[model samples]
Target: MDLRFRDPQTRIGNLADEPILVVCPRCSRRATVTPERLTCAGCALVRVRSAPNYSVWNGPVDPFFREPLWLRADCCGGHTLWAFHERHLDLLERFIAAKLRERGLGDDPGLTLVARLPAWITAAKHRDEVLRTIAKLRATLS
Candidate 1:
């Protein structure tokens, strides 16, 4: 008879083992990570994924196999805000820099920059800028 409480490691289904490309915090370079470790090509820093929330599943293997699992990376200093298909991040940074310059917030890290996401997204100009930058970034990756 098949045991209901079999060893999790020994039991086999369609275990997810995909890597996510991200930017390393220390060196600020491209890297990829699996459930095992995060490997940075630029800085040559490797770290194990001890966090349980790193790998997230959507649904059952058959039903949700088409959807990709979101892999969160934290191999860097802390929770590095880098993930796959996130070229918009670069655009967001550029936009913030421009705004800072317009407001003459020059080189001051003391003043925090906060933006309303809904407003930013709703603005046609900002949305266009983000899309354009994302396209450019994707081209570079290609």
Candidate 2:
């Protein structure tokens, strides 16, 4: 007896085992999420999907099968900004130093001094401003 039933509109609960793919509404990039909450990789915005078994499916899964978090490329900038959050200040400073070095401002005493500032100071400020400062510093060096 072939019990296989296929319905295009009908989503079978058994298929729920499959990872949900959440696409970013803004950028259309894929994101990872816990079973209950969907996170946009591009934006990092968290949303709850209207589905059961939300907890069981939450975690990193194969990108292909996972739902895409439709987000704009600009959204990913939050991740960069969040790096300086108080909780991750040390890591953020390291990242800033590395970026400064990449832009050839590593030797600038002023740039190095700014890089040593507490991550909390950076986090309290706007990331775009920081980026602009770096760019201006680079231009001065050149």
Give per-residue CA lDDT, model 1, range 56-103, as digits (tens).
Answer: 432211111122212232221332222243433343444433423232
Candidate that would win on lDDT: 1
Can you tell me which runs of candidate 1 are displaced by over 4 Å? 1-18, 51-83, 86-119
lDDT of 2 by residue, 120-142 (tens): 43553544555444444333222
lDDT of 2: 0.37
**lDDT score for residue 53 of model 1:** 50
Candidate 1 shows a clash count of 0
Candidate 2 structure, TM-score to reference: 0.24
Query: RMSD (Cα, Å) of candidate 2?
Result: 21.5
